[model samples]
Target: MIGIENIIFLIVAALGIGLFVWQIRKIRKNVLLGRDVELADNPSERINKTLLVAFGQQKMFKRMLPAVLHLFVYVGFIVINIEVLEILIDGIFGTHRVLGFVGPLYSGLMALNEILAALVIIACVMFLWRRNVTKVPRLATGVEMRAWPKVDANIILVVEIVLMLALFVFNIADMKRVLLAGEEVVGLYPVSQFFVDIFGEDPEQLYIIAKVGWWFHILGILAFMNYLPSSKHFHIIMAFPNVYYSKLLPKGKFTTNPAITHEIKAMLDPSYQPPAPEVDAEGNPVMQRFGAKDVEDLTWKQLMDSYTCTECGRCTSVCPANLTGKLLSPRKIIMDTRDRMEEKGEHPAIFAPNHYKELGVERVETTDEKTLLRGYITPEELWACTTCNACVESCPVNIDQVSTIMDLRRYLVLEESAAPASLNAMFTNIENNGAPWAFPASDRFNWADELYVPSKN
Candidate 1:
């Protein structure tokens, strides 16, 4: 048998280095996949952001039941790791049971851990059955589901299965330990005691069982550690920044029409991108995002927003367009943007027509029939959008589906000159007159039609 201290040192070093290298490589790959956003460079600020979002779980309250369940599971994690300390002690001395000053500390911890472990196990059971048995839209997935088509959901499903099942079985073993030994130095771990009372004396194999259980426990952890990088659980890394760097501004406050506050200005070009430097006679920047028709058209931050979506479909559930039976699913919109970005990965920007043919698809650009017919999305889905921010409001990750919709709208209006007749005419009239309705001012509101309604002074 190896010395306890040597084993402890080896495992800790392995875990630390393995996790570090794996996560670093994963993050670099994701960044290469168009996830570019600059967080504050200051150390304290970065630390603060990490703590509030990743640890604090600030935005996760939207789904209270799952949020609370996940919160308890996280606490359970801290508890179970305490047993690792006991293992280290045993590694140095050849026995894992607590001894000396920290003996009581660990014993008490084992009892607490046993209790939390039971709760965690129960929650896991409920969660698993809920996902597999219940037809909840979020969890009701079959072989055909995906955040992206080429992306396989099986990778994530398998990882989640391993992680949750390991926790479940590992906890059952800990409970067995607490129950088999009567009046252990550890206090009451009710669930185990309750179960053990149901099964007659089993003290004969307690120590052997503990050793076997511990081995399985460690192996399960090793598996999880190694598998972290290659799965959709990649969110485990992305979620940290996703929350910390979430949008602080309100939903409706998305953008102002380059609010023309200044009384005097000169140039006014509708095609202008940086309208501020090129503000017209009214001092308005014109909010010139003629819309993201292609991946390159998105801002670096917007690309980050795409990767951050959890594919949970909470956004789709609340979208007015989907509810009214319109083909527009906001969740689908965010999902497709992410998909297209992946399809275009590392490829230099070229006219869509020229490049898509290289990939064995007839549709290269958004204007093509394959794309318009919803190569990845349906046209009915496009027109169903009401431009409401409900999806944006509910998302914990600040995924700006509304902005994406506006960008597509911009592409249709400015590039294809296509839209619902009313909206198309409105756009034309906006160019013809200061507002959408281009009716003569003399006929406005039955005379004296020179009235403007500005809410602020």
Candidate 2:
């Protein structure tokens, strides 16, 4: 008992779903290009963190007004989407208001939806005003926020406004149609009830308007879903898991790569037997590149952090290096990582079966002229970090921009022997004198002898 209209609805839904799945697969493949990392510890704590930050929007509340406005849009969007389920069911069955049989419950739900839709529209307008008129410095100042990013933010707000309006108009038209046919109002449309007078009492016209509004609202939702993967708004979906998998260590504690540590120890003690190279689940030795020369050298969690980044620029805004006029912007570091990853995803020459053959080489060459180190991010930017952890502390999603910077720095120092002159001098002092000072370790306590000390009571 499937009609042509029902078949068309099914086809459209299938296509939307298929496209979203394809995009998701592409993103997963891109994220998997990163090196393996273990962040499986502390499940209970991670869940709690996710609930507090992502679900509760705890970090966003630090700035009160914007957070409230965002909460409106966020809560509204989520609550309003509940009605989309009913829309889908009705579309497939070619039935009108199928959930209306729920008596008073349906009316309550309808009232709630209308109120939320109105709130969403108002919030979107306020957000647009804040971005365009007020020009919040944190949002507007960064180089990354230029061009497409600025437009993208505005575009999402406008689209949300349009969608909310469509929902309101659809309800108004539906009520008008019901009134024209002398039918009783079964559902409440609190906000849209005011619009009933605006939409006059022509049954045929109201029906057409209602149909158009219904189609636009659903179609807009589908388009928004697909748009997320390519937009900074991908944070909406990524924020939860990103917060859950966040680095649980103390902010200032640096994680030294074990492979590098073993090598250093072997160099220091000739009799020391370095531990065997760690093997993966597949029994293959996990290749340890001293530092990140490209995206693949970074850990998978780091790659995930790039996608999860909201590009809110809080990290960069608080970054001492950036604030002090150094070239390092923490936000730019994350954006570059994401950009390089996306570039690799698009080209995919590295993963091709006949990649070596195509390149006319013995082994497959993954890297080309471009690299994460010198190509996207410069050594100057890497060296500017004060290791203050301010960037990590400021990040809403807990993206570890500092770790990525340090990894690249490790590559420059260990593999390329490209440390800056001042650091090289310090390194030489450490190696020969057993400390950062040029003087021997025996003289380290010499200054203390000249100073007066208080006696313990």
Candidate 3:
């Protein structure tokens, strides 16, 4: 006894599931192209943590107004969709008017739906007002901001308002159908009955209006669903996964080995890999400076951090380098990583393969002028970093850039035998005296009680 709409529902349901599976696979595949992949130990624990952070909105609730407004929008939108279940029922039975046993239940659901739809419309307006008046920083610094986003957001707001308005209109139309058909509408839904009282007329015309409104509402939802994956609204689709796998990594957690404390001569001049961390007699590691010359030198997890950046420009806003007029923006660091990844895409159009291969590594070894000056980072900014945690700490997605800088610093000091002249004596003092000082060893150990040091093994 199923109707044409029921058959269509089955097809759409199957297609939706298939598409969802495909997208999950695509996301996982794309993840490898990012930097981090380690599961961080226990899968179940991490999953629970991710779900709590995401669903609880515990972190977001701290932000106040946006959280409350967004919560209403999220809740109301979900409530409006409850009618979709009734739609499917109507599709199967060739009518949605659930009477008899569950008549009161249907009435209550309809009333709740109407109220929630209106709330959703109200929330959309509040969001647009915030964007225009308060000027959300995300909207302001957006690199691609132009006619499209402004138009899109405002248009979406309009659409939500119209859709909510249509719901009430449809309800009134439906009430008229109930009246003309000589059937009692379970009176739990007050809004539609009120409209029928104030504006009752010929029921046939109202029936047509009901169908038109229903069409608009259904079509709008479907169009928005398809658009969700492609628009800025993609965040809605992506936030769960994005926040779920978010880095629990502490600030400045170096994905690359922090430093090779003492240098071991590589077997080949192009530096075929050597055994790591050649150590001295005291069991301390003896490895020369450590650093990454290019993209491959960084670990896969580091790349993930770059890819995860929401491009919210939160880092750029707080960047001391940008403030000081230096070319370095922490935001640009991840953006540059993204650019480099794109540049090396499967079939890159133009490539200068290793044309400037002699990185700070080769340059320091050869004392090459090209490497010393005008490298990826200027010496001034390199030295200027106060190890300030501002950029990384502020980043909502927790992209780490300072650690990359530190790795470069390690290479300069350890492997290349390159240090500013003033630092040479300091390095010498540390190297010869087992510490970075010209002061006597007794004085260094003086903080500990003399009795505590001498009698020790």
Candidate 4:
């Protein structure tokens, strides 16, 4: 019973899904290239946080106008996709309105979908206007936003508009076709009904237009699916898991290195002993690096954070260092991480050959000397951060930008001994005087002594 059109649809669907899955797998492999860290504690709390931050979009409400517009696009796009299921069924079985058998329920669903599609088109237009016409400072002015990032944003918005248009065209043409045949239209087309006259009363012409629109809509969805992995729109999928695994600790609390903590403990207590070093596959002892010199040194969650970034620039807009004209932009930091990951991903053999070598399989070597720290992100940018969690609080997805910054700082200080001059002095004071002040511990109470007289009451 299968027709040529149905067979072609099946092949295209299979190919699209296969390509999407392959890219997703590659992204997973890249994310897993980072060191592992446990974030599984408090599962219930994490789920609640995910619902509030990702699903509820609580953090985005800080800026009301964009929030409302984004909500329209977000909700409309998702709800409208219910029609994609019907489209899929119709495409595969070569049936017209396959879900039309649902009777009046189908009418209600179609009406709702038509309304949402219209809203989505409106939202996407406003979004485009904001980016191009209004030139919103945060969205427009970042070094990272130049060229491809800007183009990518516009592409997604325009694509959404076109897809919504295609839906309307398909509906209008189908309604015209039904009317021409003197058959009862199965579904309500509130938005499309107004435009049905545009296609004329020619049944064959309506049929062709309907088929074209249907094909374009489904094909566009498949193309958009594959494009997500390379676009900031990936956050649509990544945000939930990223928010779920986000740090639950207080913003001001910094995570200390376990090795450094053990060393401090040993120094403070004569009876304390450090834990034994981890051993490799051959029983050779493995030493831990001080901090993140590259993406591999960062936690997998941090890498996911990079991929999940919406590039909204809310974080950068709130950043004190950037406001003061410093080299640091929190948005840039995340973008750089993602760029570095992509660079490394392209040359898997040079960075991640152990897996292949272990399996006795050879991979081509593509040598590149770049690293996340010096190559993509600079030392000045890392040091410019004030350790304030303003960026963290501003992020809609709850990306821990500060944590990544701190890890890079740790690598600079512990591994390279490259802390800033002022910080180096403070470190010396802490070591010799047990405080950040330059005065020795013996003189610590001198100011208090001067204030305290032999006052006997």
Best by lDDT: 4
Report, for every candidate in turn, its global Cα lDDT versus the true structure.
Answer: 0.56, 0.82, 0.57, 0.86
Candidate whose TM-score is highest: 4
* lDDT of model 1 at position 132: 57
lDDT of 4: 0.86
Q: Would you estimate the TM-scores of all the predictions?
A: 0.66, 0.90, 0.61, 0.92
For model 2, state the Cα shift of residue 454 in Å: 6.6
lDDT of 3 by residue, 1-457 (tens): 6767567756665565565555445434444543334645766765775666556555446457767776777666767777765654554566655443476677677778776776777788888886688887654543333444456567667777887877777777877788789987653556566677544576778778887776566656655554443233444545555555555666655454423222333422445565566567998995332464444444454545555555455566677766665555565455444335444433112222121234223321222233322233334445556568777666544456676556545556656656677688888888777678787665776776745346666
lDDT of 2 by residue, 1-457 (tens): 4689778888888888788888888888989998877888999999999988889888888778878888888888788877898888888988888889998999999998898888888898988888899987878875555566777788899999999988887889988898888899878999887779786777888999998898889888888888888777889888888898888889778777777678788999988899878898999997777888989999888888988987788898889999988878898788878878887764221211112223353222223447777766778888989989888887877788999999899999989999999999999999899998799888888887868779999
Cα deviation of 452 in candidate 4 (Å)?
A: 9.0
- Candidate 2, which segments miss by more than 4 Å at Cα? 268-271, 278-286, 347-368, 450-457
Q: Candidate 3: misplaced stretches above 4 Å?
A: 1-29, 97-106, 134-138, 141-149, 186-200, 256-457
Tens-digit lDDT track of model 4 for 1-457? 5699999999999999898888888889889988889999999999999999999999999999999889988888777878898888888988888888898999999999998888888889999999999999999986567567888899999999999999998999999999889999998989998898999888999999999999999999999998888888899999999999999999999887787888899999989989997788999997778889889999999999988998999999999999988878899888878878877874221121212122332221212347778766678889999989999999999999999999988999989999889999999999998999888798877777647568798
Off by over 4 Å in 1: 1-20, 32-63, 78-105, 141-190, 193-208, 226-232, 255-290, 294-296, 340-382, 412-421, 442-457
Ranking by lDDT: 4, 2, 3, 1
lDDT of 4 at 365: 20
Worst 10 residues of 1 by lDDT: 347-356
